[model samples]
Target chain A: MSVTYAAVQWNRQKKLYDSVIAGGVALYLGRFVGVGAMVHPQATAETLLIRGLGTAAFLLLHVVLSIGPLTRLDRRFLPLLYNRRHLGVTMFTLALGHGVFSLVQFHALGDVPPLVSLLTAPARFEQLGLAALTILFLMAATSHDFWLKLLTPPGWKRLHMLVYLAYALLVAHVSLGALQSERNPLFVGVVLTGACVVLGLHVAAWGAGRGYVEVCEVERIGENRAVLLKLGDEKIAVFRHGGKVSAISNVCAHQGGPLSEGKIVDGCVTCPWHGYQYLPETGASPPPFTEKVAVYETKVEGGKVLVSRCAKTSSI
Target chain B: MQWAEGLTTMLGVYGAAGAVFAALFLWKGVAHVDAGARGAGIGFRAVIAAGCVALWPLLAAKWVRR
Candidate 1:
């Protein structure tokens, strides 16, 4: 859905910065405590707790890493902008926790074998947990806005896309390690679903360009709000609004939000992804001058709605 | 040993703090469309917050038991 001015009015860049700072402080302070000597009911319980911490920490990082591409195509995905730093801080703390806890619980006893195990383990080790952590380590170190600003947009995107590597690593790590634990199956399923959804949204968004073009079926979804059918490589719902119902590129340019899934209000379609309102006629974003989206041409033919890939210049 | 306990407790607290921040941010965003791009970010933070919150009591309870 196209973004209207009312939607973008809630800029939270300042709030995002504050959250990041706060999260960093908490993680920083926690780092010392995680490594320090503590009270434990049993050494065994301590070991398990630390291991859990390690796993959870990695999971948090993975979640943070996945947020980028997700926000790119979807305008509503912007809220994460305010809280990304906090997420980063949380991941950092987790990685630190995992590292410290592991060091303390498994290696402190001078158990040289367990200490060496991470390095000496078979190729599978490198392919799994170790690899994931390595990617995360790189990402964490570069996470500061300073690095992001230094790196060009494309550069930042290329470097950060390593998240795919991290994601693959986490999947393997969990499949190989976590699955062995009780209730891990449930957790694994959720993780897998999440990965799929993010990936799926991306594919759908990208498909808007590469997908097959075929008019699936012409149907009236509402009064004077007719939808031109698409069912080829991509699924599009061309909304017919009054004043020459503008043909938006069917897919919510934002996160490929299903325009069909959104509602038509005030002669505009509102995206459910983030409630972006777009005038169906121009596809030009109103109010929120920040975002300008593509506008597609349309024509009503033989009582069937037809949308074009070429942009339309006629304004509403 | 005390460090380890302190670390986990802080990690949980950190998780909760991040969540509260996100929930508040998203609560406002849920009202608009520009907030959509960050939906994953908010949802993920909420999950982290919830996970941390859910496990926090258990971690604290275990400590109390000891």
Candidate 2:
């Protein structure tokens, strides 16, 4: 949102967000490593480091992925959406630590070069882990808004969708790599449950609003204001602007900000998250900006607003 | 080891070329696009160029498109 960026735009809210993140990591690591030591007294420091960081990173990834759908389902989670890049960068650091220590512990000190051994590793899970790490590195490297501005919002969002691919690879990495040899059934259950929860939350969020549904009264949608209506599994912003109602995807193109919560300013629907603006009718941003969101078909019937599942444009 | 060594050497060469390509991209290429990175200062651009060096293929594709 700036011509030039600071190292970080820190504020009181960000301080609180980062504090919660750091504290959560510390607590999760302490419990995991402490319990691991008690369960396997013979485990080495390298083993503990690998497991602890891996678990922490995986858990954080789940939370990061869930935040998007969670905010769509309920706007209370919007604050978490504001600084999700920090969460992603932190998760990448943890995953990188896990990867490095794992390579040192298992791949190094062998006849072959560590890099070669890692690449040529016969282990199926190891290959998946490497693929996941590559995606994570790409995501972390471009987490800055500079990339978003350069790539354009749509391109940037498409590239960031690789996170889902990374998640799938990491799931394989865990189930095949760690769970295969895990003695504790509790650890296995925890890993499976984590995967299931992520999948279930996404599916549930996707199914929230789909078909034609009555949203709210036309009078309720005040001028220059928006009313969020659920359809299938997504939220749509039903806007009342210039004496007409237009519906667009509630998720902002830039970082999935809640557009329903945003106010129409200067004849454009302004996103509350990063101030990215879009035309209420077409969902396209003002000229010189190419960002857009899915526009839904809306028709008023008997003083009630109804939205169709079919998008106005195939591309949002 | 031999395969890894050869690949590393190739990447090292490519990395050097990528640095130059990224600089050219930032200076000449980005200026043309209306939505491209116009306001990014030298320091930020350098970091992006370094990223291009490490991830040459992806950045090169994006740079070409831009």
Candidate 3:
């Protein structure tokens, strides 16, 4: 939709999204600080900041990760996907705060630079935390549309998938670091439950689309739109364009966006996720770009369109 | 403990270097693919470049596939 670049594309939805994020962060911090002070009156300010920010960021990350599979499971979660960048940036900021405070508290007095200290620290989980922080930094920096436009949707999405790795690293970070020293079973339980929920949701969402080779009439697939067909674990998009019918992988070659939701643009099937386009006939991008999606064979039988259960490579 | 410690340190060193390389690749790869992308301001492009760096592996995979 954005053909031109702007410094900042502000809108009502973005304003509301940012406000809710800010309010949620403030409320989370207040509650965390209040509870921490009560449980351990002797805890210092630095400890409180580290604990609060780290935990909050971890929780936010769980939410951020959940949004994808949740949306796949139910379309109601699409609203969260629209402004997910803000959620990510806010989470990264909280993580940065935690990293900075931890550095100052534990490594500032040391002779080595904080970066060096962080790398060489004797702590077991420092590396994991550092890795997670680095990934978050990349995600935050490229959260803008400018990057998306340049990176192309597929490239940008591929890059953002590093979030899964970052999440794993962070779980290890907590497990090896604070979780190790903290004796409270409740805290451990919460961490475990969070990881379980994230993992469980992903598993369920993935399974939801499996086990069905849905058959739909070609006539039912409206012009310029796609019908999403699930063939076991694979989701295929059957499109009818200009009196021709073709089927392609529902997964956007970039970022795994639902190609079924995308419309045909300029004779190519466009991905709604980031506007990457592929030819409906061959599932290949137009000349000069090498992006391609798996193409499926479709046959007409008795005045009905039948999409194949497996993908057949189209010669483009 | 010794083996674990060594493995962790090795991952840290490699991971740091990998991050830098990935970011650089994303920046260049995106610009290469999209002609209009290079027209953007340097600051904004640099940010995108960092994202590429962060996701170098995925970008690399897609780049080779293309």
Candidate 4:
């Protein structure tokens, strides 16, 4: 949304979102540690903190993962998608805290160095945790637009897709590390439920996206607005602008943001995530910017907007 | 044991180098390559510096070319 990037393009919504995140994290950690102290008087503060942070991070990761599919299912969740990276960075910080605390408590006092001890630890769970942490670090480090621009949208997306791998690793890390010692059925059930919810939502969203080429009645699309369509694996945005209907790949050239969620501004399709704009007809950014997205052929027949699955042309 | 020691030493060297490079990059080199970084506040530079620590080599290459 900015010609020049600052630390963040801070807005009222982002400030509120960050405040909520900070408050929620503080409350979760305080309540968790306090309750643990009362429940297990013998447990050390470090142990409680490690457990609290680990669980909080795990829970936040679920929320972060769910936002994508949730937004796809309903536009109401778009606000959550807007500041999702902050959630991710916060989750990484929590995970890093858990890792550091666990390392200091279990590995630091030993003769071997902590990193070496971690890698050499007999429990494969610790190694899995380390692997997941590394992936999270990579993601957190590159969360900024600087890296996105440097890596390009597709490459950056590919790197971030390793989150799925991190998620799987963390699941194994928790199951093999904590679940082995804590044979509590409730804990197991909660973990299973979180995983299932994430998986089920993704599957449901995929199903919902299918067969959207016959998008909707042309009248349903408002002027200067768009309707999202998914033909096979491609997400296309059909826009009604200037009394002409045009279709373009919904993915933005910058950061792969959903263009369909955005509206036309200055005669260009402005991305909702960031204000990256593209001419609706050509799917190319305005002059002085070189970015382009794939354009698709669209037609109005029987008052329904139909989009071609194959791109008419791609200048990406 | 030897490999771990070697890795630890290599990482230490890399970390030391990265820290130095990151400090200098934040001080001067960042603005040279990225126009957005010019006149940006310390917070922005700090974030960029964090990335610079890990990606100093790449940033260094860009700096040299610039």
Candidate 5:
């Protein structure tokens, strides 16, 4: 979408999204710390802060994990997908804060150094927490488009997929660390509910059938709009424009964004995430840009649109 | 315990080297490799510095290749 890459392509919607995130985090942390201090007067400020941040981060992760399936299940959730990275980076920041506070509180001031102490900690939960934090740090660091360019979409996607592993580690970390120590049945119920929601939504979305043999009728696709089809493992975007239909890979060349969510603009399919464009017929960006996506063969039979299982590159 | 100590030492050295590499990369090397970084502002460079520190080895290879 941009000839030059900036730190972030800030827009009105992004600013609003970030503002809401900041306000929500502030409110959550304030309420959590305040209520904890009032209830547990013996708890130190650092302890309350650590608990608040850790809980906030865990809750945010649930929201982040839920956004993908929610968007797939209903297009109305697409707005949440646009600013999901901001939520992720925010979650990582809070987790980092929690980790730093815990390290300083527990590991520091001992004869052993903090890093070594953390690594050699007797508890398996500590090790799991450290591993999860390290993965989160890597993900937050490489969340930029610069890294996305360096690591191609597939590679970048694979790396980000490590978030699921991080989530698993954090779940084990919390279960072993907090659940073992706390007798609160509410904590157990909350963790179980969060995990089940995340898992359940993903299963439901998968069962919603992204892959369809017959996508839909040609008339079902609005002009300049696309209907997403997953044939086998390949996701294809079938676009209708000017009385003709064309199909291309649903994955955007930039950041692996869902191109099916984008609309045709200026005779080119414009990616909804960052507005990256590709010609519908050729699946190639216009001159001066060298991005290309796989074009799929689509046929209209009996007014139904059927996309090919195989992919092919087309001449521009 | 020994592996943990070894890891700590390796990470210390890597962190030291990465800090130095990140400073230089943010100062002069960034513009040479990414055309988009040319004439970019301090905010952009500052934001990228975090990744630069973590990924200094890869960036160093890229810098050398460039």
Candidate 6:
């Protein structure tokens, strides 16, 4: 099983169940109960639509985007990924609601201007929403274990990084959409800040330059293959063969994830994050059109490993 | 078509939120999610299902209710 730990954690089944329950609740509230009588009764169609969209968006963002960090926070969260599709599907569903309600209220059979405005007024901000939505749609459309089996974990994860892009766009989407409406300055600000914080945490992990802990010692490594050197920052494993030792941030570029936890497969080190394969020698990915990570220069001195942190690299 | 458009749209987006959460909770683990301590760490969230039920309406009312 790609989920190496699923058998051990049987706890994942519960999360899966919980997702169903949550969806049921949303349905019950929005449809069964309607959130209409008790609240939003006199709401502008715009308000109901926006509010619904916002709630859905907020839920998906918190659940999906928070995984990488939460994993670091706790390893048990690993099960989250095993069934990540379930979560992604949930997010997409919510986002769909947000979008539809938006269309209905703001543009559903409305006069030309509202329609045009839905497309135009929120263009700048909606552009971000569009970007995030587009990516989310692609991901959701492709989020089957079938595709996961078809595409390598690396490929899957690389595609998933668009989550960051989606997130950035979403922050902009909400910031401007909510802000302009001045719906609730403090509330919008708080949500926006929270969204930024979630996204920033992921960026910070990338900035930390994780994975591939670098240890540079020129003489021993010799050029055949680069062995990893554990650094305070990361546990990098590199290989130098055919005149170039590829270097990626010691962290798995796929998830800003750790690589040390991964295994060596087919002359490449598989990333622990999502089992992405990197040629330690070239830091290049295996197939199709994946991007390569930064390569570093190493000089060996009596077993002392030295690497020039500032090195450039090309993609696959 | 209205129902299709609205229902499809709503399911497609708003319904997605939980699925997304489920993904991260499965993949990312939780804050303070130590392998040895996972049971306790996430159980807290499991319990929050109720809190969330409450929190959701509260948040919806506060922000999106309009």
TM-score of chain A of each: 0.49, 0.75, 0.75, 0.75, 0.74, 0.58
How far in Å is the alpha carbon of A65 misplaced in model 5? Answer: 0.9
After superposing candidate 2 on the true structure, give the runs of residues whose Cα lies further than 4 Å from its correct spot.
Answer: A212-294, A299-305, A308-316, B1-9, B15-50, B56-66
lDDT of 2 by residue, A1-316 (tens): 4355544657999999999999999998888889989998999877987999998999999999999888767778899999999999899999999999999999889988777788777787987998899889878878776677756677879989999999999989998988888867998889779888888888877776356778889999989999998765678999988868889999999899999999999999999989999998889999999888988888888988888765775334
Local accuracy of candidate 3 as per-residue lDDT tens digits, A1-316: 2243433466998899889999999999999898999998999977997999999999999999999889878878888999998899899999999999998888789776566677777886987998899899988987888667647777778889999999999989999998889978997999899999999999988787443244677788889998888764678888988887889998776788899999999999999989999999889988898888899888766656777655677322
lDDT of 3 at A234: 73
Which sections of candidate 1 miss by over 4 Å?
A1-45, A69-74, A82-86, A111-115, A122-127, A149-151, A208-316, B1-66
Give the CA lDDT, 0 to 100, for residue B33 in model 2.
Answer: 42
lDDT of 5 by residue, A109-159 (tens): 899889899999999898999999999998899887877777777778899
Candidate 5: clashing pairs of residues: none
RMSD of each: 16.5, 6.8, 8.2, 6.8, 7.1, 14.1
Model 4 docking category:
medium
Candidate with the larger TM-score of 2 and 4 = 4
Candidate 2 TM-score over all chains jointly:
0.73
i-RMS, each model, one decimal:
10.7, 3.7, 4.5, 1.9, 1.7, 11.8
- Give the better candidate number (5 or 6) by TM-score: 5
DockQ per model, Cα: 0.02, 0.25, 0.19, 0.57, 0.60, 0.03
Model 2: CAPRI class: acceptable
User: What lDDT does each candidate get?
Assistant: 0.54, 0.82, 0.80, 0.90, 0.89, 0.57
Residue B27 lDDT in candidate 5: 89
Q: How much lDDT does candidate 2 score?
A: 0.82
lDDT tens string, model 1, A217-264? Answer: 344545435354553333445665453545555566556676666767
